[model samples]
Target: MIWSLIILCGVITFLIRFVPLSGIISSDLPLSVKQSFKYIPLAVLTPIIVSDLSIMENKNFFIIDNFKLYAALIATLAALIWNNVLATISIGMASFLIMSNF
Candidate 1:
């Protein structure tokens, strides 16, 4: 049963990926479509980061922490200024680790 489920998932993944690359759909998209797709990463990551940064307790829910949120902010700045993936991730992770230790 597990093997069958794995095979099914693999097939589904293959179909999802393959259908996009195939000629069944038009490759040329409008400027609006491209612009919206470009913001997909930010749209997806913002909520997750905000949730992690926020403090949630029985009495208080609005408190912001020191480590993860600041690290993420610095990382975001690094990415914007440097436009480099490796540097952004390194700065983000390093800051997170360092701040977490304190």
Candidate 2:
């Protein structure tokens, strides 16, 4: 089952790239299409990140000492300051681990 799911995902991913880049859809995608695709990462990531902030450990974000929320804030700051993906992720995960152990 897992193998089939993986294969299906790979095939779908390949087609998403191939159909556009291969010119089957268009040789030059419109400016609008390109701009929309840029937001795809944010659209995909926001909910996944929000779940940790809101519902992780069965607690609300406003509750005191929510480590995931703190970690996310740290990660957001790191991203804004350093603009480095590796640094943001490392700091976020590290802070979460440390705070959770406290």
Candidate 3:
């Protein structure tokens, strides 16, 4: 299972690299197409963050005691304020640790 996952990821990585170099997607992309490309990060990040915030270990969901949700909010704020990758990560980790213990 792990090997297949690794191989699959490798193949995906290779294709992501290869497609541009191979000229499969040309630089002649339309204005709309180029603009929509801006959403790729949000498209990728939204599902991961949303799923994490919306799920619980017991297969139930509640927002009242959601320390992770709070931590994520804090982290997002830190990211916006500091705009530094290391600071955002540190703040996120520290906030999660502090919130979860309380």
Among these predicted structures, which one has the highest lDDT?
Answer: 3
Assess each prediction's global lDDT (C-alpha) against the native: 0.85, 0.86, 0.87
Off by over 4 Å in 1: 1-13, 26-35, 54-59, 62-64
How accurate locally is residue 14 in candidate 2, as Cα lDDT from 0 to 100?
Answer: 92
lDDT of 3 by residue, 1-102 (tens): 999999999999999889888977886878998899899999999989978887565677768888778888999999999999999889988998998886
Candidate 3: worst-modelled 10 consecutive residues by lDDT: 53-62
Ranking by lDDT: 3, 2, 1
State the TM-score for model 1: 0.58
lDDT of candidate model 1 versus the reference? 0.85
Cα deviation of 6 in candidate 1 (Å)? 6.9
Itemize residue pairs with steric clashes in candidate 2. Answer: none
How displaced is residue 31 in candidate 1, in Å? 6.2
For model 2, residues 5-93, the per-residue Cα lDDT tens digits are 99999999999878866766756768998899889999999998887587455453364777888899999999999999999999999
> TM-scores of the models, in the given order?
0.58, 0.77, 0.77
